[model samples]
Target: MQNRITEQPSNYRDLEKKTIEELTKLINTEDKSVAPAVEKVLPRINALIEVIVAKITNGGRLFYVGAGSSGRLSVLDVIELPTTYGVAPDLFQVILAGGVDRLVEAREEMEDDKNEAWEKLEANGISKKDIVVGISASGTTPFVLAALARCRKENIDTGCIVSNPDSPIAAQAVYPVEVITGPEFITGSTRMKCATAHKMIFDMISTTTMVRLGRIIDNQMVNVKLINHKITDRATKMLMRLGNINDYDTAKELLFQNGSVQNALKSLNPDNYPA
Candidate 1:
């Protein structure tokens, strides 16, 4: 029951009275603190990522459980992994409060329903092989907390990203990441700075995990799915560069034949591909 820093008053007051420039400047100033707060928790984030990579490597999935803005952001992150890294659609999933189908409705009240998250997770056949990470700016959301609690009872590993210290959600997590982004520009409106930090952390976790799983080669998304003209063109160019082919048409042909830059490169030099 300690004070939640995210719920504290904003550092800048009288927002309604401030000029447009003044408001933007003040908000930007507060925004500068979010990165350092995340930086302070790098070690904790790394620990969670390590576990995620190991579990996922051994036929496990990563589930992000959250509500409100956190849940929406997680959805955005999970949906991109497949096209970005050529991973399976189900490899990374989300268990959003109110359900992802109703995400556009912004059903904030559903966050208080503690039973829903566990039911959804159970329906997904959650087991010890999967890792679930909770996302809640307050670190006290009933929906996320309950799911993690059930996960613990079932011996499924859990992790969390919260903006408060010593929160109940963190206590339930085996690998807790407390970023402590502090009060928002608008008092208790965690959708601002807290959401920003969560987005950054999501980028870190997914990008790093994909890299560790050998989805990248020399900083290129070699495993990226060529599902569009733009991406196909990009992958074709990447193949030309990596395969040392001077002709774009030839590389494009190779890319289409193999279906991916990684595969095209493998066809060119099988020894270059990772084991």
Candidate 2:
């Protein structure tokens, strides 16, 4: 509704009669711009990560609020935090515009109601002990902005990830993240570039925050929950490599005994020294 396509020519229209190779070239070109845009916001992002780490360390929670494509992506990011970094599921939550059913399906009409966002947060018992990161593309999503405003009124720390600088959402948040991913290839269809930018920003935030919370060691996800065979396999290998064990059996045994790669390494090696 912001008429974002009018401001950027590259987002005006799609190729009408282009070859597959040509279309791919254009898309790849647009994709390349996303990271650089995110790069500009790294300093702000680092600060927000530090803040989130402090809150989490103090037994607080992290909330992601958004609508439509942004909301679905935020949910995906938080859903993986537990298995990927060993964070508590209850500590990380997603508040979509119309709720869980809308995430998988469509609920475009729900994006207009500002009060619904606050209701969602209230249902979760949001407090000042929590950190909220709102995601929106045009930075004008009433749902996300209103949720952030309510959080601010309640004295909760708030941040945002948006594609436009000086957006209304950014203006309302204390720590605003402006990725400036430009316009979409489909002219205001933010599910394209904006969605990718929000995902990248969410990844950076979660990964960096977990690192600060000691969930990682030397680029290894040491706190990853072994919730499945794939994770179990990864944990076994990590334990084997870190403990200098010779066989899979020894690694698996230690992993089972200690229940974690970090603990297994401690049992096997004691310290990073030749035994």
Candidate 3:
């Protein structure tokens, strides 16, 4: 067993004696270290992202398997990709320990089941083409570790995000990112800095993957779905700017007709816009 720094005693003691303001300030100070911890592992993160991009480009999907806060945070990230990047919802998926349907229930006990994660992955028709990334702040969550071990046995590519060094979960991953955020402000409560690191890393993974896959055009979400009036209006303006159209109504009309900024731009006539 590895020394789990996340479970070590916090640097700050006498928490009960601290004032509300003092508590908040101390927590905020600890939060400041999370970004730097994640930064230290960028090379490992880059390696994982490269594999993810290649697999996705080759028609494979990305699967995030996690438990507790790590799992819930992944759900938030995966759900936004479709509307934000205009990609299929199935392109990114999450397999939470207690089933995503029961996510709000906070079934922390489910993380102890060693076989459930692999069973869920198998039911999804998991294959070698698809990549599975485990999220476990403790680096020893049985649900996540079991899944990664099985994935390796089945010849599937695996990666992991953990806060402890030489963790069993990291050992199973071909590409492991150990952010090592150290002890949480609340001792073993990984939902603090560890969760923050996981959330930030998820943002980096999804956003960078989308950009590399060309879902973003010049830093703009040109492929974004016009799901609501606000999004539609935004896409309309984007089309107007990118298509170089002079009239808002005309741009909105073309945007509606084509369904998105990317498509509307494609429908524009080369000679219709001023040079």
Candidate 4:
């Protein structure tokens, strides 16, 4: 068992007596502490990401599993990969303790069902070709722990994002990331600082992985989806800038014809296009 840093008592006292301004300032102060915590674990995060990139590049997929707030955050992370980076939707998947179909509802009791995650992964045909990341701020979610243990038994790659050190879930993770976010301002409410840490790392992983996979060009989201007028307009402008076209209509026409920023650019520069 580990010292559950996320479950520690709040450093502040008499919260109910504080003014709203004081409360906000205190919470903001605590929130500021989150980045330093995540900063200390960047090396571990980098190592895990390297493995993820290698596996995913070789046809492997990424899977995130967790419960409650962690589960919801995991859902948010992978769901946007397609629209944000133009990655294939099939490349990222999330298995929430509460069914993804029930994402709008808080089915906390489902977290106790230790077998559900494993069953879901099995049904998804999870194999050694996939990398499973368990997200549990307390580092003790039964759903995530059970799934990671089973993945290990089956020789599948396993990693974890946890806020506590030496936790059971972390023990099961071959590549464990312990961000040690101390304690939430609301005691055991991990949706605060812990959530912030996990969210930041999720962004890092997706962005870096997409870049390594050739989805990004320079510092731009050259693979973004133009699903709406705003994005279509933005992509048109980006194409004009990146492709060095003088006419907006020409850039917009090429962008619409090719579907995405990357493809649009490729159409204009076939000689320098990737495979």
Candidate 5:
């Protein structure tokens, strides 16, 4: 393979000879650079997020298409939206090249399946109302590239998050975010820094979209799912604090009765909430 920055040798050589502490510090230094790399692409990221928000608010959906580590990370990001922001499960979808069932199996060969992502998106009934964002560290994953190409040909809005510049995936994307994370500390282990950048960007996109979509009230996740004791307890506390319910048990009771922090708060005065 041709030399990309990701394929270059590590700056600190003889890694097997280094102590655990030395290795950790070296990796830490490299990891610190990831945030700045992402910062440089904030403008591009902002543009892509604007498009996503527009599409989703109009009853459209968002789809993340990728393979390998990128695909798995995208899957993780989308799965959290329903619980975290109370959006519909289908609002943020993911198309993993090998399917989510094989996500952890290290099925790297699936990245070479250029036709799979388009098929997956088509199966999902992707339309111009939906926006598909491709994720790839090298910006050359055939799975992602082909999907974006198909989306463009069909006039669907398309975007991409990649770690390299002037890559094929970016060329196919209408709004391409290229966060140059430089070389990986382990020289090709994109699961480290590249994944971090993608995670941060995903956080930005999903959180901002949710907040704009009215899932958040103030800084709290008022619409968050109360699926477990931990979250139930947290929501109860929020209800007590926001609704001025001095009694803890009463606040907890209200939470169970209403089912969500937003609902609990609105119950205090129906006039305060929209019809």
Candidate 6:
């Protein structure tokens, strides 16, 4: 069997050396290349964001599916959405090959199974109104490809972020973003450049989608939830600055009364609302 992952590596010539400085320099240069590779796929990422924003604006949720490191990344992105954008927990979802347990620990023979991924997605009641984005580095991960294929069959909108060109996972997705990072410093260690590129792509996708959905105002994170002490303090300051209310106590009282700065501002004045 051909190892699709081991077959690609553009930096093997440099890893053969024993010098520490050589390895450090080679890794730094390779890491620097990740952003440019991601930049090449901006147009594609933007399109996916547009679709995601439209769906979310229409009361639809977004889901991320992947396996191994890719799966973990998806989980991270979903977990952060609630705290960052004040979106409901269900607004963003994630699935892994071995389930949530695989997040902290690895599972054996999990990614190899094609049927398990769709089963998990189906259990969550994925439908046409929702958006699914599969993340894979090799672009041939059975788990990721299977999830995308099932989504296609169900007439659901699907997209993929992969690190290989003409990848099966990409071809299966309606909006495929291929970031060709070439290879790893340690040969097949995709957790290096591949993971970084995947994160870059997801950051662009999620942030842009949030912006389009009006979670952001100007460059500010206007939708963040003030659910904790730190967030409450930050939200109070932001409201004070935005509403021209310099009194800290008044700002804190307003935020506590309304539970959200946007709502508080809107309730304070009908015409001066951010909406």
Error of 5 at 66 (Å): 1.1
Off by over 4 Å in 6: 1-6, 13-17
Q: Quick one: ranking by TM-score, best first? A: 1, 4, 3, 5, 6, 2
Every model's TM-score: 0.98, 0.90, 0.96, 0.97, 0.95, 0.92
How many pairs of residues collide in each model?
0, 0, 0, 0, 0, 0
Better lDDT candidate (1, 3): 1
Compose the digit string of candidate 4's lDDT tens values, residues 139-189.
899999999999999999999999898899999999999998887898889
**Candidates' lDDT values, in order?**
0.93, 0.81, 0.92, 0.89, 0.87, 0.81
Clashing pairs in 2: none
> Which model is ahead, 2 or 3, in terms of TM-score?
3
Q: Best candidate, lDDT-wise?
A: 1
Q: Please give, for residues 107-141, the per-residue lDDT of candidate 5 as tens digits.
A: 88888998988888888889999999999988899
Deviation (Å) of 58 in candidate 3: 0.3
Least well predicted 10-residue stretch by lDDT in candidate 3: 266-275
Report the C-alpha lDDT of model 2 over 1-275, residue by residue, as the tens digit: 34343136565354888788988888889889889888888999988888888888898888888887877888888888888877679877888888866576768788888998788788888888998888887788899999898888899999998877677888778888877777677676788888888888888888888777777767787767888899899998887777778799888887888777766766666665211
lDDT (Cα) of model 4: 0.89
lDDT of 1: 0.93
Query: By the TM-score metric, which is better: model 4 or model 5?
Result: 4
Mark the regions of model 2 whose C-alpha exceeds 4 Å error after superposition: 1-14, 267-275
How do the residues 15-60 of candidate 1 rate in per-residue lDDT, one tens digit apiece?
8998999999988998999999999999999999999999999999
RMSD of each: 0.9, 3.0, 2.6, 1.1, 1.8, 2.3
> Which stretch of 10 consecutive residues in model 4 shows the poorest summed lDDT?
266-275
Query: On a 0 to 100 scale, what is the lDDT of residue 195 in model 2?
Result: 88
